[model samples]
Target: MAFEYAPAPESRSVVDIRESYGLFIDGEFADGAGGRIKTVNPATEEVLSEVVEADAADVDRAVAAARRAYDRVWGPMPGRERAKYLYRIARIVQERARELAVLESIDNGKPIRESRDVDVPLVAAHFFYYAGWADKLGYAGFGPDPKPVGVAGQVIPWNFPLLMLAWKIAPALACGNTVVLKPAETTPLTALAFAEICQQAELPAGVVNIVTGAGETGRLLVEHPGVDKVAFTGSTEVGKQIARSVAGTRKRVTLELGGKAANIVFDDAPIDQAVEGIVNGIFFNQGHVCCAGSRLLVQESIADDLLAALKRRMSLLRVGDPLDKNTDVGAINSAAQLERVRQLSELGTSEGAERWSAPCELPERGFWFAPTIFTGVSQAHRIAREEIFGPVLSVLTFRTPAEAVEKANNTPYGLSAGIWTEKGSRILAIADKLRAGVVWANTFNKFDPASPFGGYKESGYGREGGRHGLEAYLAK
Candidate 1:
């Protein structure tokens, strides 16, 4: 396949602070305290914008606004009226999808194809899906008259910025809760864009507030006494800290965290399809996906054949400019994250895992890591046990179905898992036994608005999509 290069889109000037960003508070844009942070494009290592960094005082102000909205406006609003606002927001999202997609690609370093086609569309769909449920909470199986928990404090990750915001905010609003949302420090552009959509939707003042900042702001939002519920999507380590921080509070918490999912291919599986699934499982979004199937567990009988096919498929992947239609992988999200991936990959080699990479050239000025695979990996190896969260795959082999199941469930994280087999009975039997939240039979990384998504164990608690997601925002 021939590759093409596309010019980077003109980014809004980083120095022009007003055009770049300010905190979205009380349904309007407002300057933060003296704190400000420069947002960088990880792909090109260029500064994109100077975003207002919400300090502890700003967090207090945002939380107070959210609390007041919950007490006076949003919480008291009728469910049908709340549904109308969500529906309007959903429409605005679709109308402005292109701009959001472009901004997301520049800010988060994900491919334009993904942000345009996958993330932006899914975000709009999520709002639409949840909007309809606002007035139908009686049918959501959360009891007869389910009510919103109150003000919600939501913190989303940088991987899928707009989509994560939708995942967090949609359900909270649908359930009648006002929200104070914090986008990841590295990628706040789309979240700020979503605030504009909320304004266009004419959502009630203080119903949704976007506070841009790093860990300290997140900590303040999560620990705020006025916030009645907390939702977070990020690493397990951070999720655990949030869990501990809110242990005895009146706040309800839901966490969608890290994963080291297993992609198991049985001897009876179709080699071509299994290979494609393996590639899509780990390499999608430059392997920045939390539910990425980073561990490849192939049956020993066809291990060599499958590995060869996978390698050939991987070699064809295009890695460069996110805006190019043909680019399969894009840049890493940040310098720190890239360094983490490199360090973990080095540990894989030190711990005796044979590493392999296809012949590919990365961009000269960007943070890029080639698609990497480690063979001869043992279950005890650090690469096999930890979540690398990049385009790095560790291969392992199992001799029997029992062993496959054992190895797949060995990890503490269980967000999702993929199973490939031609045998229907085997697929069902293994699917029933797998400990993960989502089981993709013969397919990997498939998402739908109607289906629920979450993790079972240390991958974190609570569901993110479908009818089950409403439970997180509703009062028990």
Candidate 2:
């Protein structure tokens, strides 16, 4: 018999969700010309709040405000002076960490533990890390007195709302560039909360602005003439569209797109440790992560043992409410995303792969998916080739290390990959042969603000974290 866990729901009273919100332009909340869209809590399908859907005019206003800030205040500000504001913002983020975490869980449908421990902390860390870089750009190997790239237009996805905002806005502001950011339509609450934090920090008006909306709003922002830089984190298809739109423009663009990462396990790998890594890889944040290790490649000799252990571990994963502290898998972000996960999963089954899902009763109301793994999956299968963006893992067997590398590199995505082995030599050797931008040995989904993170090929280009992140906002 499995051990049962009692309900331990995190209190939502910490966050004060307004009934409606407006666009944050020039550091003030103003009415948007575009209509409003209601944001719902996926965990309960309850309407959380309605936020403004920024129109082209709103995008234009935001970009112009950022431009004005850049040219008048932020751009001419000394790097040391700019560092102070960044540090203040970081401190404010730390001060209100719990409220931000609870808001994130409520809006994003991720477990409260993840929002509290991983997302919010990392969001603060990125600001702090980049704050240190603000005054020390000369020592960063980017030449003496590197200049700002002017107004930056940033569009963040819903998976990790505040973290993605921090990733885009922190470095841009630290580098003395003003930013007009668009948080995803579904999860704009945290981004709006971040705007309030900016006010608390007394960040200069127009230095950082947030305009929330859907795809059309994003398009307008990205294509705006006032913005000198464009940073987007989303699907590969949208990334490509942005690339095409900016092809003839002078805008400096960086895109962190989709992935179909592979997690390779050697025969000599620690089964228990590998199982944990595998779980963290694909199921973390309900596998909404772009760089999630969706493919599991195990050495044929120990495939059975690994699969047995992995299934047992999967069975133990609790799935349900995002506010639950014991929940391993939370609700999917939206109804459309849940439908996408379902369609891909059904395709995985129809393509002749054996499907096995964890034994858990999902909530009747919310958009939820249990942890799942597919055995007998081939490289040719749709589940193996395409990005599912869900808590579905496809398992494949490889006879040797060379075959593993080949199978892993076969995907167009080059975001991230994992190698599990006790031997350091094999780990290094396989890592060298892998095509991924990030290769982890015996671990998965680990992130740090001090380290650079990005991808190659169809997965997208440029770095987001660390010293490399500043380059995107700096004039070359």
Candidate 3:
């Protein structure tokens, strides 16, 4: 009989949700064009809050505010003063970490453990890491004195709400650029909370303005003539649109987009560790991650053993409430996202791939899907070719290292990839051949603020951490 763990739900009292949230602009909360969208908790499908939707005019207002702050307030501020503001923001985040984590889990549909441990902590660390760079950017390899890029328009996705906010805002502020940011429609609560943190930090008015809305709002922000830089993290389709929008203009742009990353395992790899990596690579954050290793390429010599072990490990994962401390897999971000996963999984089976899912029970009320995998998947299958953005894995086998490399690089994305092997020589050799921005050998899904993160090719361009991250916001 399988062992059952008792429920350990995190208390929701830590976070105080307001009835209706307004757009955060110019160091204050302002209403939109009278349209409000209800933000729902994906775990219970309950309305969490009504968020203001920014119309084109609202976007214009935000851009104007950010520009004013850039020219009159933030732009002339000394690096030491800027660093002080960043440090204050970081301290506030750490102090209210529990509240932010609870709010994030409720809004994002990620497990409490992840929001509390991975996302929230990293968000704080990102600000803290970049804060130290505010006064030292001259030493960041560009030159002795670098200039700010003026106003930056940033759009972050829903997968990792506050974390992505940090990735965009921290570096921009650290480099002395004021910002106008838009959070994804599905998850805007944490970003809103972050605006409050900015208020607590006493950041100069309009140095960081958050305009919350749907795609139209983001489009307007990206195309605004006042914006000197554009940083976007979302689907590749939208990234291309933003790229075209800035084609004839002098506005700088950086995009961090989609992926269908491959996790390759050789015959000589440690089976248990590889299994853990496989689970983490695809199942982390419900596989909504763009860098998720959704495609698995395994050597044929150990294919059967690895598959058996992977299946055994998967069966033990707990999938349920996002607030549950012990939950391994949380609900899909929304109904639309759940549908996308269902469509791709059905396509996989119809295309002759064998499908398997963990025997874990799913909640009846919310948007949920079991952790699933497809074996005997071909390179042509939709599940293997596209980004499902859910907890689904595609397994493909290879007989040679060359075949593994070819299979891993088959996709248009070059965001991230993983290789599992105990042989150091083969690992280094394979690492040299893979065309991914970040490659993990032996470990997977680990991230730190000191390390630069981004992608190559269609997966998008520019770096988001370390010294390299500051370059995008600094004058060349």
Candidate 4:
């Protein structure tokens, strides 16, 4: 596949602001209280735009706007009317999907292929799916008539910038709740673009607000007393802080956090198919995926053979410009994330695991890491225990199905796990025992708008995707 740049289908020449971006509040863009921060492209180290940093005062204003919307207009609106707005938003998202995808690729450094195909399409489909549920919440298994929570404070990560926003805001709005959303500081462009979509859709004022800033801004949004609910998707550490911060408050909280998922391959599994699943599990989106199978658990009997095959497959991976459609892996999301991956890879070597990489030339201008594998890794190694959140696979072996199950559940994180087996009985048996939120028997990283997604245990709670996702925004 040759690299190709697909400009947004909408007019790209219309982007107006050259320097600073404002926070979206009360259906309009407004300046932030704190100083301005520059948004940079990790792929080329170029400054894309400057974004307003929302301080405590800005958080207060956004929360007040959200509260007013919930009380005066949004909460009193009929479910059918809310459904119409959601439908409009969905239509506008589809219309501007290409442009959002391009902006996402530039700001987040994910491959354009993923942004175009996976992220954008899913985003549109998510709003569409949830839109239908707005008027039919009675049949969604949440009792006869579930009411909307007052105001929701949502904070999404940078990895799948626009997609995460859609996941958080779509359901929240469809359920008749007003929201104050904060996109990660590094990738605020798509969320800002989404504000335009909301405006075009004629969504009611203060129904959805986008506050652009770093961690402090997120903290303010999450800890605000006026927020009726809090939803977040990011690192486990921050998730814990939010969990603690919202403790004892009436704020209904749900977190989609980190993961150290294991991709287990049985000896009876088809080798070629398993290899493909392995690559897609770990290397897809440069391994920035939350449910990415960072740990490879192979059967001891055929470990040598499988390792050789996996190495050969990895050698062919193309890593370079995210705009290139041919690229298998793109730049890391940021310099900070690159440092985190590097430090953990070094820890893997220091902890006695064997590190290996293919002979691929990386772009000198971008923050890139080759698809890497660490063999001879034990369950005790830091590489195996922690969520590296990069295109690095740590290989370990087990003898029996029991051992595989044990190894897979060894981590504190349990967002998702994978099982590659031909036997139906074995697959069901293993799936039953694994303590993961998602279990992919024959596939890896498969997501659908109708499917429910969230983590169990430390990986965080609350579903994000399916009919169950409505619970987060609904009053029980």
Candidate 5:
């Protein structure tokens, strides 16, 4: 019998979710003009909270509030004052770290370990990093002084609810722009909780507004005539729509979209380390990452050896409870997302690829899919071309370095890629050849607030972290 670990679940006592949540506009929780949507815990299909749906009227209110805050309060505030507020927000986030982590895991269907260690910590760090830049914009490489654009409209996805919020809001605030943000309907609890944090930090009214709803809410927010800047992190399809909507307008826009990243492993690479990196690349966060390395490109010479190790390692992954501390993978984010994974995986099989999944018992109540992989995958395969955005890997072997580069660059996405090789020169050669914004060598799934993150080509444009991110909110 395979060894089974005892359950070690994280306590939900730290978070106090209410029966219903409302639109967070002007630093207050108020009802939306639209109806309510029930946000469920994907791990158990439990109704976590009913979130107010923002209609066109609500979006207009948020934009007007943000415009008011920008014109009268946040935009004119001294950099030092803004810095102090950001620092205070960061400190409060850290103090309530456990609560936020629990809330994120419950709403987003990610394992507790990831919510605590990766999502929440990074969320706070992002604020802290940008906070220091608030008072030091003169040295931020954006020329002598950079002014924030007027009211920014931001829309975030369910994958990393709180982290994406930090990504959008921190830099906007640092550059002195007030914002109206919308969290995805499937996961709005944490973003609503963040309103309480802004209150704790005593951030000015309308400095940050969070409207909760589906695509319709985001659509109206982005299309609002009062919004001077738009920042979105989600599907490529929607990214294109937003880009088209702002084409003839003056609103500055940035999109952090999807990826079908390739994780390449060479014959001479360390077998064990490469296996770990492969697992981390695609399996991390149930593979909900926008930059998840979903495509595995192994050199034909070591394909057999590398795959053996990868399969053996994949077999050990723990799947089930998001709250379980020992879990390696959790439920898919929602029913619709799970259906997409199933459809794509089926397509991969129909296209003549060998499909394999890790053995694990899934909870019957919630959305779930075991860690899966497809070998014998070719560039012509749909799985190899499109973004699965789930814990599914497509394996394709490359016979030469040139062939590896060719296969990796064939995708429309240019978000992220991984190269594993003991040879430094070869790593540099491959890295230089691959057309991706972020390249990981001998490592995968690493992120830092100081590092710039975004994509090239159709994966979407504009940088989201580091000094480049500051440019997004500034008047050039």
Candidate 6:
């Protein structure tokens, strides 16, 4: 007889969600000139809170505040002093990790285990990592006197909300620049909680400012004349718009955009391990990852066996409440995202691909998607070429390593890819030939604070997460 598991839902009482949230400008919560946006929980479709939608005027105010902070406080502050503030923030993140994790799971619809174990811990690690580099940047080979780029305008996506914020903000601050960031409208709660963290750290006013809103507010924030640097993480279409908007200007920009990464498995690869990596690659965070391995390329010899194993594993995935500790997949981030996933999946079937999904019951009220995969997928198919950004995998068969490389690089994106084999020489050789910014061998979606990450081609430019990341926020 199989073991039946009881409910082990994480308590929501750890977090205190506010009824309404305001913009975080100049180190305090303030009313925005624009209207309000209600953020809902994707798991239950429950209205979490209404946040002020910052406007062009709010952007102007935030930039002014950031400029003042740059000129008078943060920029002139010594590196050692800045390190102290960053370290303090890191400690505070660790102290309140549980609260932050619960809040993230509530607002973002990621599994509680992921929010607590992966997301929140990485947030603290980033602060600590950048803090160490704060006083030692001269040793980083950026020269004896690397200077700040004044005010930075950063915009983060709903996926990995706080971690994305850390990716953009940590290194910028370590280099002594002030920032004004805007979080995605649907998942602004955690960023606001981070704002309170900033206050708790007693960070100087305007050192870090968070403005909550949708696309329009982000447009205003990034295009403001006062910003010296702009960083964005979202879709490729919007990234191109920002690039065009910043053209012929003095402002520097770094875009971490969309991806349709490939996970290549050779005949000699460990079948069981590759299956697990495949699951983690596409289904982690319900496939919202920019570098998610949505394209699975399996050698023709092992393709059938791999597919069988993958299907069996997918059948075991638990798709339900975000707060459920045993859940493997959680809700889609929003209604629009859910629709996109559905439309693309429908297109996959209509385009002559065979579709299969995990047998799991999803909550009727919330935004949810079962883990799915499509076989007989061709490189010419829209599902193989475009970024689905959902828990949908498109499997393609390759006969040789060269063909695998060709098929993997066929997409316009080159953010990340994975290679699975036991041979070290093959791993090195294949990784060298791949066009992605990061390649994982025998594993996927592994990250570290010391390792730099980004993308190539339309996946966007510039690096984040390490010493290389600091250069984007520093002046030459």
Summing lDDT over every window of 10 consecutive residues in candidate 6, give the lowest-scoring window.
1-10
Candidate 2: Cα lDDT at 95: 96
The lDDT for every candidate, in the order shown, is 0.90, 0.94, 0.93, 0.90, 0.93, 0.94
Stretches > 4 Å off in candidate 6: none
Q: Candidate 5 — which residues are off by over 4 angstroms? A: 1-3
- Clash pairs detected, candidate 1: none
TM-score, one value per model: 0.96, 0.99, 0.99, 0.96, 0.99, 0.99
Q: How close to the true structure is residue 389 of candidate 3, measured as C-alpha lDDT?
A: 97
Q: Number of the top candidate by lDDT?
A: 6
Model 3 CA deviation exceeding 4 Å by range? none
Candidate 6 vs. true structure, TM-score: 0.99
Tens digits of lDDT, candidate 6, 265-335: 99999999999999999999999999999999999999999999999889888899989899889999999
| Preferred candidate (lDDT higher): 2 or 6 | 6
Global CA lDDT computed for model 4: 0.90
Q: Could you tell me which residue pairs clash in candidate 5?
A: none
TM-score of 3: 0.99
Tens digits of per-residue lDDT, candidate 1, 364-453, equal 998999999999999999999999999999999999999999999999999999999988999999999999999999999989877999
Question: What C-alpha root-mean-square deviation, in Å, does candidate 4 show against the real structure?
Answer: 2.4
Q: How close to the true structure is residue 398 of candidate 5, measured as C-alpha lDDT?
A: 90
Please provide, for model 2 over 1-476, each residue's C-alpha lDDT reduced to its tens digit, 9 standing for 90 to 100. Answer: 98888999989889999999999999999999999999999999999999999998898888888888888999999988999999999999999999999999999999999999999999989999999999999888888979999999999999999999999999999999999999999999999999999999999999999998899999999989898999999999999999999999999999999999999999888999999999999999999999999999999999999999999999899898889899888999999999999999999999999999998898899899888999999999999999999999999999978899999999999999999999999999999998888999999999999989999999999999999999988897
- The ten-residue window of minimal lDDT in model 2 covers 137-146
